[model samples]
Target: MGDFKVLRLVTQGELSWEVETRYQQCYQLTRKTCKKIKDRVTVFQAPGGFLFDIFEIAEVKHWPDTDVSEFTSITEYVDKTLSGYFFDQELKSALKEKADFFTFGVDVFDVNNDKCFSHVELVATYDTKLGKVSCWTGKSYPTEDQKRDFINCPSLETHCQRLNGIRVLVLGCHDLNMFSPRSRASIAPGTSKEIVINQMQKLCDQFKPQVVLQHPHATDSANIWNAGWAGVRKFLPEVKTYSSAIHYFNTFGGEPRQPLTTVLNRTATRDVQNIVFTCFEDGGIDLV
Candidate 1:
């Protein structure tokens, strides 16, 4: 909890099985990321679609790395990753038997401050209904025709976490974009746009977090899809909003977006920080 440095995995266009036959991707990727990361991640930020379609990796599961200065914690998934359409029975069965699953994620606020996982408090992101995209077919479909992809949120919430004595703001891709009416209709139909934006303001004003992380798979993730964090900047003018996204030209298909890694600063201008990683390289970035 002393150093504020963090290692980010941009998780380029290699979301699916790089092996092409066996889905041995996440662990291999994590191991490679571990090699380059020179900082411990008591609290981490996972880019959207890091492994599965969309998930938040708030804290690393294994800690007590041999050297905190060169944090080398790696991850492996072991649960049934996916059980829905777009996946056949054979593929699902193979994944459940051989692949690993993330077992350490809860909501950011649900973590126990009194408890520590190997001398480090664990912070997790509780997937809530606040800004969850519904039955995403990548396009609209009739309500009845749509299947129940997921349902029944324990609660609706937007939150930031306190980790290693640092106030960190974690925004899902749609969470920040909730300011738009169209986003409301798709992401959280029952809510209003103004309420969404105001909630972010409340968190920023109350916590005065120095760092922010937003992960998405969109092309313009560096600019937050062209709608920058302008609405909330006045309150958090000094905060550095960092972001990581899948590389442009991923299998999802998109044009090249440079400065693939960037941070949105006080004045709401993007401070282009192009950080790149090949399958063999190892390095890290400081949060300070």
Candidate 2:
């Protein structure tokens, strides 16, 4: 696990769907910490400090164990504890160039040999485009709703509405129905059930998400995908869908001039459907 290395500092903030403020902060932090992986280990200030899960970007291991003991403070963990022990030989210059744009709010971290490497950068000074400092570590961020995982369409819609302002975006993986590389070899009722449950749980836990909108067909049940009407009968049997809280809409077959509409607006405006919830080939959308 200690062998886990920083791949490269990915510079494409727009591609990562990060907010401009957070994006720029990540860029600055990367610049300050851009040392040849073999030269020195870098650390920075984690705004909320190490308590948040975002501190694991360093790819250290047994991270949860460290939370209880060691370090004078979260800042000390990065600047002193981990940084002090990190040998210059551990880093390789070739890999630093591969780092990508990341943020501290989403709390990106990785485990490596009882140590967790967190890419954190908190800004004490505020600049218009550079909000309260951030990071560029690569990790899954929350949806517009600030939710790591989602259970039903209502939750998905709720997330979308919250992202109306700013770069917050709502995206889905369409076309591919319930297929993950992790579950490729088997086919069973238990397998399908487990797959949905595991995916739902992990997404929520790691991402700490609100809505995880998935196609109804992705589930073991066949009746759920009838235009997303099923709405988590099995995945969330206890939850109730409040009519006032949910919005249902379709994203297909609109005028060429004005297509992709949601149920939020009655009129067919061009911007109304700009952000449609989906279930397609890729699902990497965010506010930026």
Candidate 3:
């Protein structure tokens, strides 16, 4: 489920969550300033209905603010309080299916020190509560540069067997973009694939890790959707790619709310309707 954050609630006054569909349309159009939340969710009630607790996904603050503090109806409030749990349950199911086949691991390291790799270790050991990912190995590292590079990038050399490993070296936002200039902006045609290719090769040479993952930011990806994933494909042709792959718990301040594509892939086409309807019943944002 998306993370839910409590926005302003009517303390002295009573505001029902119920509102007309037209009012909902108005809210949707005006939530731009209020959408900068973590869970990145919006709440809306069914047409000609009421909401109980008004719940807004933490990300709604990213949207343009239009006096969301003002309460319109009571049902909207109820919808906020109750719908979050419902959407959370549904989102859990959806993310589980999305992450099932990715088989990813993390290894974090302190950028300043050679001792603790926080990101890599966290990814490798942290278990997904939704059961989408397998259990963590809880592996520890003694050295700053741990090597195991042949998993994603194949190596024919006898010393480098293709082991299933996720080794990573954290680079700052500036350094990553230095390798791929296109990565500095939105991924587009003729982006410098070589920059990333070179970086991967250099990392492989230095660490000899089975696979290497990078943490690219919107600045590195030009704030484009899935820019990192796209950069992976464009830059590293030798590695395997997964369609509809999503970042694991990475924070992107309020990217547009894309419908759960991974869930739609596993479930039937008709199920999409149910999923979407459930999204609303679960966490659709509407103004009273």
Identify the leading candidate in terms of TM-score.
1
In candidate 1, what are the lDDT values of residues 1-288, reduced to their tens digit?
A: 134443344444433422221233444444444444443343333344443321222243322112222111211111223222223444333323322211111111112323421211111231112111111111011122112221111111223555445776655444445333344345444333344355556656777876655444434334544444543443466565444333333344564445443422221224322223332112222211
Better model by lDDT, 1 or 3?
Answer: 1
Candidate 1's error at 146, in angstroms? 12
Q: For candidate 3, lDDT tens digit of each residue in 1-288?
A: 112111111011121223333234223322321232223221110111111111232222111121223212222433343334323454444333322211222222223333322222211111124333222221111111332210111111211222224322222122223234354454344533333345444654655442222222112122333444444445544433122112211134443333344322421112111112111322343332
- What is the alpha-carbon lDDT for the whole of candidate 1? 0.34
- True lDDT of residue 277, candidate 1: 39
lDDT of 2 at 284: 34
Residue ranges of candidate 1 with Cα displaced over 4 Å: 17-23, 39-44, 53-158, 179-191, 224-226, 238-241, 245-247, 250-254, 257-288
| lDDT (C-alpha, whole model) for all candidates | 0.34, 0.24, 0.26
Superior candidate under TM-score, 2 versus 3: 3
Kindly indicate the candidate among 1 and 2 with the higher TM-score. Answer: 1
| TM-score order of candidates, top first | 1, 3, 2
The residue-level lDDT of candidate 2 at 175 comes to 10
TM-score of candidate 2 on Cα atoms, chains taken together: 0.22
lDDT value for model 2: 0.24
Model 3 TM: 0.25
